[model samples]
Target: MNQERSTLPSIWSAAPPGGIDRSAFTGKKPNKIIPVPHEYRRQTLSRERDMLIHDVEQKTGCDLVPHWDQGKVTSFDIYGSGHGVEKATVYLNHWISNAHTKSIGASAWAKLPAYDPNKWYYAQVEELDNVYKQRFRGPVPSEGDADAPRHAAVVDWPEDIKNTSQEFVSPREVFGNKLERLDELRMQDKVYITLQQSNHDGHWYLEILGHDVVDVELAREHLTTMIQTVRADAAGVQDAHNTILDEREGMEVELQQCEPWWPNQADYVVPQLLSHAMMDKPGSFRQEGLHFKQHLSLQRSIKAALDDVRRRKGAYDFVVRLGCLALSSKTVSKGIIGRTVSKDSFSKQIHESVQLDVKKWLANNEIGCRILHRLMAVKGFLEPTKSGGYFGYTPETLKETRPIFRGTWVFKDPNSSVVATQTSYRHPGRPAPFQKPVEDAQAAPMSLFVIQIDWTDDEQGMYEKGTPTFYKLPPGATGPKKNMDISLLELGESRAWHFALESLIPVPRKTVSPVLVGFAERVRMKRNYDISSTESFAEWDTTLNIKKYLQTGRLDSIYSFGIEKTCYKVELTAMWYPSQQLPVWGLAVRHLEWASHLAELEDLPIGRQAMWLDTISSFLPDDGQSSSNIDEDSDDCGTRRLKVDDSDDESPRDGIRILTDKLMKLSEIVSSVTDCGGVQI
Candidate 1:
């Protein structure tokens, strides 16, 4: 049949015997089967096997290709015994591949009768050539690379390569079983290590070879969670610190604009008085002077806020330090491994970077804490003393009059009225004139005095006259002494009395004329007596006494008694009386004296002016009338009084009060920033 077909057409020949041009007559060109290079094929197959091994290791958490004593055994012969004959043939079975099956089928098809299963070897290979084309044939994974080593097992198989049981074995199941065996070996402490003795006689060198895969993964997860938590806490602290900074800046600007009066040596006394008043009746003082009390309350609140901020800052610092310690521990653990381990350098770099970040965070917290402390200190300096009614009058003091003095006098007869007098000259070895007979008397009798006492604050008896009385003198005294004791006590009450003494002085007598005995002798005697006389005539003017008493009281020499005459002594005491009327003229004169002392400033500063007006207003009868309508004119006392008109809301007093209130509100806002719920870590 072949001879007959060749003779007819020779269709299979490259060219037909006849010149028919069969190449052109063919319908399509036959595809060429290009031969793959051996090196390329090997590399491509190696990558495919590595990818498969990596997939199984990820699922099983085990090393499919384990390290051996001779070197990294990349083949299935884990013992590296070239014969490959072992009772435990499980690993050899797992190394079987399609290449072994193809080679066995080719030999079986060849009909070789003496084919040995032990001679058949396993080689890692893929059935589809497309798998080699799809994979990237890059450099093979190295021992230290994070990727799985690109290795494939080549083993001398002891079993038939065509066994269907080998095909049913899953790579993941085999690796999982191997991992369990590794765990068993680890638990039994069968994993061995190499120890080298150094050249020094007493020295021994040790090296850490590897770590448990499970333990390392667990540690990594734990550290990752801690890192995420630290990052969150850091973000929260940053936000809070920034908010505090902004509030503090705003408060600082407001504080700069406010020029509240600062306390001086003279002004410090008012704070002491106010503190005492507050201590005496804290609740009442706070209730009555709510506006004024805001200054102290805000100060305390700010201090407490500052303390809270400090505590939170400390906690934040501790957390930062703890994070730093954790990072350092991680770095130290990494350093325990060989320097050739790339993660050591990476971990050390991360630790250093975190340390710098921690330092910056702590520095920012410190600066914010310092600013809060400064704000607290500034708040401490704003005391409500100088401009708040001379220590800020309470409701009780505002309504009632404060008595300057009180006295009780015993009389021999109820109808008799006696006047105490001081003699001009006193006899030697006798009691001095004007001296009280009763040593235990409440107050000494005044020789010449003028007093202005509160009469009645009610509208019907607002101008009631003050009664002028005198203490009875001893029988032996005689002189031009004026008994002056003024009382605003109710009528028909004589034993006990309340009064405010305005002035007191001893009266002096005029010089007596010398009589002439003979014409020449009388002239000589008159001239000699006039030359020797040291006493001078002095008039008793209550106005001058009141002025001298207001300015310097007993401190002035003009109101002082001479050494030969005894002076009247008075003991004054302060008492609260709901019915007692305020001495308006006396207060006015005292205010005038206070103003005169500040004459160098020309006019009181706005702060002092407010204080002065507030003090004067407190004494008023709460009728809303200004000082001008108070009727403080005292023609008898002859002292200048303050007559301030109610300048309405334009007054400095009201303006200062408003400004102070605004400042206190601002302080409250500034302190609110420190109210963090608690420390965050």
Candidate 2:
């Protein structure tokens, strides 16, 4: 296969200073592609990206830190995304230092409005390295030199230093071709950790690839002092937090006594030197057990190595710091394309941080949800519209006009039932696909969009869209009405529950009408199943609408042959249409077009996996079943009794009862969590 066709081509952004030439990604013959103008090389981002990056840094203290040292001739790419998730993260990199296999370089980033020190420092460090490489090392070869860190680039005595080395060499002899014969510099048996505190004070490990006896004594003292500094700071911060909590009760006592507390104060601890030099090689020790064992072992090795140096070379009595963590991961592999550290390794720190952030985000959202439930006055689902300006539609009646909608509002009441309190870019439910709309630059998010629904009346009263709200199926009419008489559906149409479909739920093949299923299967299994050409398409034009059955009141059935492995859990709201006297199967299926998050369902822990079950229990206002419970003309979704045989648990009501019991247990867990929140931890 041609290489270009075999792989996804890189997308090019806005054009650069030069007019467009041969596209870098286009698969022209090698003979035709090479020796082209340099302007045509390298991918770039749109101008908007540069502006956004600048705006983010200026408005929010966050910075984007990328990996350095692997300088290939490529343009900068500021934005990246896959699926729906953005790829802005902080990670660690394991690099080759001197002759050691791995040297750790941790990189981190913060989004705007959170000027994280680690992230800012990481970016600044990379920037300095980039400048030095561009100036001293010179522009990369047009085609690019992948074999990097030229012997000359490594000769910088300041950052690349053994300080004790007696050997000396000039950059000219290395890169300038001054030497008649070339020689590769090699480092000797030694290990060193260089902490870059600042540009002027930072230390380096080597002048070239050559190794030498390291100054273990100085290194040990530095390591011990830095660890002590970090540990002390952490302890101090914890102490301050404890002191603040202790005084909270004092405020109550003081209020009783009409007294005032003293001023609050605490020292801010600067972040540790995450950007440092440490061996990146895999830990020489491994035991087939949990991580705590490996963590303890790494600390032991550090301490043991320190003791060995002290015994032989009289280094400081440096104790290894346990319970401390640092980030380091390999970001590239042996391939032409860039490789990265295993996601698990690189994302460990970020994962912890994200979990904490997400928990806080969720907790706040829970509060928001409560406030919204009180404001909206209804508990059914409300999906955001595609437009950026937040709009929510809650169906009132089949008549489109009666549908309740919340729209624009301002500081004061805008005469609408729903009120908008605040407008912000960040929304709590933004993570969900239903609410994650294409962001509108012009729209400011409201603090709260009040539903202003007349829930009391809607719940108790019948839908007011059409008259004759009773079940008198027009005496002698074979059919209720014409197919398009949508308003012919009578009262109790609103007594519906939004059901979240489960993959594990048993769906009988009989749930779907045999005729429809047979036709679908036959059409799908045909030798040329899909119609491509206009001529071929004409042969089965009947297949187009796929909804011809809705007219005959025969559209009384639904089928679930199997779960769509790729799609998310299907959610359907079932209603009893008294005119047709059953759900319009096609109408219920129409809900599938609306976007919803599958990840949300998957994210629930297994113990709390019955979220849908809970929704079903709380959401159902009524399930219209007659005395006979016989569907003479079966049309409703639940026409027949469905059995769930879990250990011979055959009854549907029993299954629901069991699920409800579990829901109560989970509710208690939630209460416990809320109670724990008030107590300081």
lDDT of 1 by residue, 197-285 (tens): 44666333221122344533332333233233333333332111100101111111100110112111111111001112223331122
lDDT of 2 by residue, 1-681 (tens): 687655644333222222212233132111000011122222223332334344433433333211111221111212222211112111100010111232222111112357789989999997776444333222223224453332211212232211124333332322234211111101111222211223685533222211122423333333333333333323322100000101111111110110011011111110111111242211111111113432233323322222121111110111100011111113222231222233233235333331100000111223322322222231232222211111223234222111111111111111111211122233465542111122222322221111111111123222211110011122223322211101100000101111112111111222222223223333311133221111111011134222332222111111111012211111111111223222211112111211221223323321122222122112110122111233446575443333221122122332232322222222222223333321011
> What lDDT score goes with residue 73 in model 2?
17
TM-score of each: 0.12, 0.15
Single out the weakest 10-residue window by summed lDDT for candidate 2.
Answer: 485-494
Clash pairs for candidate 1: none
Report the poorest 10 consecutive residues by lDDT, candidate 1.
316-325
Residue 615's lDDT in candidate 1: 29
Deviation in Å, model 1, residue 188 alpha carbon: 97
- Regions more than 4 Å wrong, model 2: 1-76, 79-586, 589-608, 612-648, 651-681
